[model samples]
Target: MEPPGNATAADKADAVETRHRAVLRKFIVRARRVEEHSLAADKERLLAWARGTVTLKFEPQSGNSTMTWDLPEEESLDSLAARCRPFLLQGDPVYHGKVTNALGFFLRLAPDELRNYLREIRESWRPLDPGDRETIGYESRTGSISQALGDLVTDKELAYAWLYGDLVHADDNGEERLHGHDIDARFQAGALLITNVAVKAISTLNLARAAQSQNYLTLEDSVFTERVVARPKREVRVEKFATAPVGTPPAEIEAALDGVVPRPDSSKD
Candidate 1:
């Protein structure tokens, strides 16, 4: 979009630059929020699952379950990815026609050094080599495992497959492909990719801010936050129950464990 008709060429260029800066700043702020609330909030849990410190267990007599620390009930990671879909979404904004991605913003407006750094961060999301049989492995639903010798899948592919297939919308082929897999592992793996994206965004913003301070970036200071005050950090608290609360009725306990323990209706079958 052109500036006012009376504006000079320099004024028009400045207007465009200012608008780009504003969008870049917005992406940075959103990235920080996602990092803190979505990723950081579940960092330990994600890592635990990724490293197999915590795992899902299925009881032959009962059913499958994740540990309390795993936070099986929390959907923030998946939901956050869904909410930030536009960051990875391709194409330009409908009306603005400006790029709406962190990497794109950096590539278009940032210095060469900063742009390269962001690019590297993005590339890190891709697997080192899809055909590396030694590192990559595959397992089917039947518990058979084999080396990923051919047609190996990359981290990006697996992550997006899970994201589009299971969480966001049910893509028919994606669903079939992911069928009969360890659901928690798939979810966590996809979340790791999402984490990379969040990290890339936050890193880009921080680097841009640092570049501006160092005069590597010559943009006006209006695009960055002036005073970022840190709020007091809250402590995480967990309450535990060894068994049903004292004085709880048998029927209430049964109701509480309705799904975990089979109900009369289900057992009848």
Candidate 2:
């Protein structure tokens, strides 16, 4: 995992762990055979849309692995952590304790601070008592605590880096690059939650309006005939896990999706 040009060697090393371990979830969004003009415009549009501090996990896919970004938002850590308490304490007490402990360790807060936070969490945990017999509702909020904690941590680190000018950068070389500011943030833990948030957010966006607003540039050279045929294909390949420590890399997750489902080879007649 080499860092992009313009990045320091230390930055590259930091990025390997930060990007690989911290990503919680990944989404693959693709548009095929769009007009070349539209494609170029779309790429720019996507980059602009992605800019800014939002609490989400995003990374553009390349050949082998993806470089994940932890978007920031204006939310306090305690508030966000409170939102996730119910989800953390839902089913089993033991599991809830484990989650709370993990979060405490990650936040580096004292026992007293953890207790105060848990007190606030307990105070706010009354909604589940209302007996709302809805499966979707439960699932929807099941990961709230984890999600909120993840968001707060990401935002906090990003905000600090932004203020101190300690953020890492990589050149945009027509490919994806990873940032390596917070190597110990455990982004992978929050990946799924942030991804869900991103999906819901994108669902409400008007892409057609975006397309219309951007001026598409034409190649003015290449042309395609009307009879061109495109084939739909899907394939799955499994490989042995020989990467970093288990659970340290994205591939260690039991539910993480890996590899490309290549499009079928096409033959011209």
Best candidate, TM-score = 1
Which residue pairs in candidate 1 have backbone atoms (N, alpha carbon, C) closer than 3 angstroms, thus clashing? none
Q: Write the per-residue lDDT of candidate 2 for residues 1-269, one digit (tens) a residue.
A: 56789999899867753432222111001111222112123444333323422344445564354444443232322222223322333453322233333333323433464446544443333222223232111121112433532222233233223322322233231111113324223232232232222222232112211221331211111211232224457566857333445455453433233443434448833
Worst 10 residues of 1 by lDDT: 128-137
The alpha-carbon deviation from the true structure for residue 149 of candidate 2, after best TM-score superposition, in angstroms, is 28
Cα displacement (angstroms), candidate 1, residue 237, comes to 31
The candidate that achieves the highest lDDT relative to the unseen native structure: 1
Give the lDDT of residue 200 in candidate 2. 24
Where does model 2 exceed 4 Å of error? Answer: 1-66, 73-78, 91-185, 194-269
lDDT over C-alpha atoms for residue 178 of model 1 = 49
Q: Each model's C-alpha lDDT?
A: 0.53, 0.30
* TM-scores, all models, native as reference: 0.51, 0.16
Model 1: lDDT equals 0.53
